[model samples]
Target: MKKILIPIWLLGLAAGCQEAPVEASFAASETAVRFVGAGPAATRTVVEADGTEISVVWGSDDVIGIFGRGATAGNNYPYAAAPERNEPSQCTFASTDMDKIFKWNRGEQAFYAYYPYAEDADAEPNALPVVLPTQQMQNGPGSTEHLAGLGVMKAAPVTRVFSEEDPAPVGFTFRNLFAMVEIRLKMAPGTAVDVPVRRIRLLSEAAPLTIGAGTVDLTAPVADDPLDITDGKKEAVLVFGEQPVLNKTDYQSFWLMLAPGRHPEGTLALEVTAIDNSTCTTTLPAVAFKANCNYRQDAALSLDEFVPAEAFNATAAVTECRVGEPVVFALSGEAETVDFYSGEKFHQWEYADKDRLEYSDVFFSFRAQMQGGAQLHPLTVKVSTDFDGTFEEPNILTAAWTDVTTRFTLPTKPWTANNGPNTLERYLEEGRMISSGEVNLSAYYDEKSPYLYVAFFYHVDKYDATLKNSRPGIWFTDIMAVRAEGDTRIPILSQTKETVHIVNGDKYAEGEAGSDWQGTPYEYNGTTISPLRMWCVNNPPGDRDAYAVTNKLERKVSNFGPDKPESVKGGGNGDAPRLQLRVCGTGNLRNRTGGPEQDAHRRNGNGLPLYGDGKTLRS
Candidate 1:
């Protein structure tokens, strides 16, 4: 229910009347009317015979001749209308109780008849008591959509009624949002009865707290919108009044856009208010309206989040792919932009003035031309934009790899596959390895990240960076990871779901730097990258470990070598370098141990393998 609470002066219900309830009670005995109470004298308050609400009113003198209390004299004691059942009329002293009481009825020139309270007379739907018939169409300027009576029969058929010989009140009801409200009005004869009210407002729906807390104001700017005002065919009708004028038919409208978590009511309200002639201010009723109201679904979107899928679909339709394709995930909402990316890389990668995976899916198919004995190769893909702030959220970087390792019938050759620019695939020719329907590629990257990540809406595709590089159409299969590149010194790293493969000290071009949280000094510990303890004391003081140089050119730590771990009673050395080294049978001057002979390396004892072609090295 909609309720309005304000100072009494605000309501025009009593217009110029100043009399209070108490004043109305004292003057009740002055008129011919008597205040009747229901119970004993002490507790009795005036009541209608039907037990409904009773007011100070003069009662019937119907039994005057039979009772003898001045029978003839009591018959016409005061100014009362003749009663219907041949009984004297009953009336409320309200007609004469206050000075303004009589003044208003005179000014309003209205004839009011007071009767005994009638029970069950409240607004019961079945009663159908004749109330004010209000629906009136003003034979407007344009054609009305309801002219043929196609939609509804509306309030009444005979547009307007005049009180020529008979008069009565009529009630009109209309739709305002989800509410149906009726208003009471009294129409008189020959008044023309067509008063065009300007503005009409209906009470808003009850505010919901979860959608918000208190009342929020939603301003629906009403202009001439065809869909709302007319049936999508008519121009909007402009109106100006404290009350809204019902179109030739039945419609006034309210439409608006609002923010998320916002609802409006109270001061920011809608309703038909009584307007003054000059200033045009008016009183707004708490219930119902003379004109418009509505609720619309799916009216707004938010941009506070990321870009939504609809936006990406409109923007990033994976036209091309090399190994695997990117799966589109929509984060559509009322957000200014909803963003959810699987490392949301560019589908069309361009590099060196050429485009890879252009006009293709995630994974593209390609044939490889391998040279003899070139088993290892580098697989690089070009991307457009980067959202991986140096690849933070990802533990690995991967690409959607097309299983390009599709080998044919047993080949006559037992050669290695090189991942050079020309070599796309390399593997053993004879065995089930070819029929496994999967590819175990040995691709190298110069970054600390996994190769590159790929996610596909479908199954695996054959990985062919060369195909994406050479062809114009390649589809993305799934996402694969590669370590991210940065100023990382660890290079030639090839990692998969299981182990991390690396070629010692791989290098990249001048600007090819990225990072992987699991690379170098840091390792993934479920949550964040933590420093590896082995790199804690990269260098040590003198006598920390005895290092020896060998003629085999293999540097071995004499102290922390095999014999030392054998004597100590521990599962394993906590900081031991789990690397194996061996010397050629015809040792090329292998030494017990050798590394960069810098003071820090010697003193700190952080030594690893070193080629004699160079001196000492930093591990």
Candidate 2:
């Protein structure tokens, strides 16, 4: 049968007067009464009425209290209190006073009732019972104190009036004042082992209720509400023995009777203490609970698996210059220069003769030969912000330069001729290479400056250095600064040939007996027949070579050996033929034989033998 559950707060009542003549009947609804317990069978009961035994399910313990009002009454009187079930389903009132009989239709009358009547056994005979405090109302039974166990206390009211002409069964609807809560433990999926549940408890802020006038003052402050009950003692906590397992299939379950209140804001905390385990305890936050409501909460606690973070692998594509085809730098003393001989060709500074060289502003690019594994290294490309057409005034290292490497997005392909322009593949087979794209320098370009000092360096960490030579070397090709406006290629560095004058056996030569190359000697040989005295240039004659013979040459053979020369023969007679060469104007002439300097000597300057003291051709 369906039974209506109700909630009520008992209060101090006025004295009840004698009941007038009234007739009434009561019957329960078809709704089954819900029992709050550890399980479903806690609410079973049997009711007897008029010598007939009826198996009726009471919501809680088998106890009932009824109060009635007559047709002309001053106050409601408690007329019947039945604490247990009779044999034949017949419930008889304790009071047999017939003066309070039912009268036909004088005024409306009703009955008020509550379950577990003995819970209020200390009440006065004709007066209402003293209302219990909210905390004391829903307390569990203590070992030393016999308090009410986990059960429901409801207040049912009947509003129907009875008469002989139209008899109506009075229906009562009960309302429980306390909320029912059931807690169960579970484990998360893939949890291989079970953890024992040592203890469980709720946590919340406390707000007590003051009992009066058939209602509760929910605004009262409590000294021992959920928030105040932190001792976790037997009176304040719901204790449980240590369970063997707390897993998905096997776990601990229990119920708790909490005081009725609106817990709308803060969460209802359930702290579960696991038995001697690595993960000792866990608290389930934000468990919601409402006043006078039934709650079934399942908490799942799982151990988080350990997973390591991923490592960073940085890669890049660099373009490199081929051997014998490097982007040569001009011999400008402004930039630091280092020369190493690799191939047959001498790779000297291109514009070493010029006093100053200017290069157009353009993009610079190269291939970076990264030797280390997949690791990100700092590659900085800085350009002089205020070059000011000079290399000395502002040192390139200390001068103001903006790093433009970050401005360009470099390609990340490994250096290979197949992926690069031109015949880079053949070069790769010979050596390692990195293909780098054009790094734009348009932002820092200045048209007025004679030359822009630029530098490229790699700041690699020493830990990531895995090459035989820890120091990495970068090669570059197509390394011209081109001005896009006019498609002009700046002359930063260019190869040039020059004829350098050399004297055989001269003190200024590489190995000589007496040479004043660094300083002028006080007394130098004006003329001599010593085989070393025969002047000769060291370079061989070729299509690219030119010689300017100002004074007529006297051909002679001179001994050339590490030991001293024995004698000198005239007109190409010794083992090595010797041609007497003369140094004319400006003995420090370039390597090229017939160039602008030779032309100038033939035009305006005197054709004097550079070796003699301006006296005779043979001198």
Candidate 3:
């Protein structure tokens, strides 16, 4: 629920005059008294600076008489008669004594007035209703200070003098001698429940101002009055009991009149009694009640939604799973394979496999299964940092290569015939069949060599023996990276074709390398194929069984220098290597030869020494 409290000022007239008199009468030319405010109705309106409508009860019973200077107990002349009870809007005053008609001389004059005139004209004739500073007025007969009801005083001094030559009637605007307070209660929006309020009360310690001829002193100090009416009243308490709150937008308004001074500096306690004999109390911050100013306080009640306590289970809430739940995925249809280290483009390492390095201590984890229950093949992971863009002179691979196969590990168990039907359930039962590994390339990381490359080496002998010239499925799923923190795992590859796709091996051919080779076209599958996927041929087909290996795995490069020590780098702590690379794939050999692999024992296009024995090239 939203609650807003805004204070708005009511403009009171300092001086004003009635419309031009139809008859030639001095009384009609006299200034008329009025109040103006922002309320929709005239009676509810108070004085505001920009208001135009006259107060409905200006000269009615609500506001009885007006007295000018020198009009005291000893002299009753120069005063107006009681406001016409029948026509409250009437502004012109009437006097019975013709010799002492109320007249405005050619000079300034001041006046004071009170509401609910005194009935007894003899006892304290000029004493307006007054109360003790700490006494609370209740709505009852004993609360009255005099025959007049609750008193509200206002004093207005007309500074502009009136003259016979002036054609307009003079005007005098009055300002309140007491402070007006209004309390508003509302329900929060979207609240469907109802809160029945039996009663609402506002309690404050207050006292009256000193009223004198043409002046009202609101700042006067309060004095103890033991002789004052002492029934059961203690402090000023305005009680509004049994109000209905029907809907979210329902609201209730209550107004009170208090002495023209700041109340005691303390919370104004508001007690709300519910229909069930229960009560809720809320306090508002201390406020100052300045004379002639309107103070509005708004409160909004919000109801909390109901929730059953019995539905919570303490045991299950704190339980933690030690073993990771297995995720299963499938790969179907043709798998595209691209050669990484062959042609001029491959020597330049211009492919989608290159990426900017962003994490330290990167770990690659996945569950892989070879189709037809074939034994898992050995895989090699390597990293490099010196390969730049020049392919004409220094071959890309000759720059540097670090074999990181020892960083990888095989699963605990191997695949068995008896497994569950679903992918997840089957993988869990045959979890040992999956192979996972980590590559810590922190040593290759440096600001001078901003880019790091990664590659995978599949044994040519194993590919030729198991599946060659055929798309034998090799399923990989749940391929993710663990950064510096063992717990922080970011997904790098997914089994779904849409998330992971093959880099067609033929696309690595010399002239075939286009803009698509530089991390663009492959992005349509949702993930960018890094430029590092350039393929390399270890030995020509004539010398040995040709096998293709994945190449050019580059980490995300940084334009800024290496991260500062003790400062956060990328998404991990800067103390360790901050970069990760993950590659997942399926299917068998789509062998390539020719272009740069014709001469054996010679430096190939990648500038790597070629040997007849597969072991020399593999190492």
Best by TM-score: 3
Off by over 4 Å in 3: 1-63, 68-90, 95-111, 121-127, 131-151, 158-170, 188-192, 205-236, 239-242, 263-266, 302-619
Candidate 3's residue-wise lDDT over 16-122, tens digit each? 21112222212225433221111111222122222222232343224333445532112223234233356543343344346544555445544433332333322
- Worst-scoring 10-residue span by lDDT in model 1: 545-554
lDDT tens digits by residue: candidate 1, 1-619? 2222231212111111111111111111222222211111111112121111112212332111000011111111112222224322222222221222221111112111112222222322112122111122213322121111111101110111122222222111111111112121111223332333432222234321111111111112211110111111101122232344322223333222111112233322333322211111123323211111112111111112111111111112122222222222211111111111111132111111233221101221112222222112222222211223232113113322232323322122212332212111112223312122222222321123323322111111123343321111111111222222233322222223222211111121223221111223222333221110000011111111110000110111112111111111111112221112222111011111242222111011122221221111111
Worst ten in a row by lDDT for model 2: 610-619
Q: Which scores higher on lDDT, 2 or 3? A: 3
Report how far off residue 118 is in candidate 3 (Å). 2.6
lDDT of 2 at 301: 61
Quick one: how many clashes does candidate 3 have? 54
lDDT of 2 by residue, 1-619 (tens): 1111111211111100111122244422232111111111112222211111112234222444555455523122223433224331223333223453333334566445444454344342233332322222212211201123433333333455434444334433333444445455567667787665434556555432222223321112211121222122111234443233566564344445555444333433444444431232333333333333444555566645211112111111112232323222111111011222121212121222322223334555444333222324434556764634333312333457676776544434234333222233333344444445665455564544434555543332233324322322222332333344346444332111111111122122344222111111122143111110111122211111111101111111222222111121211111222212222222211222122222112111343212111110000
| Better structure of 1 and 3 per TM-score | 3
**Candidate 1: lDDT over CA atoms?**
0.19
Better of 1 and 3 by lDDT: 3
- For all candidates, the clash counts are 128, 45, 54
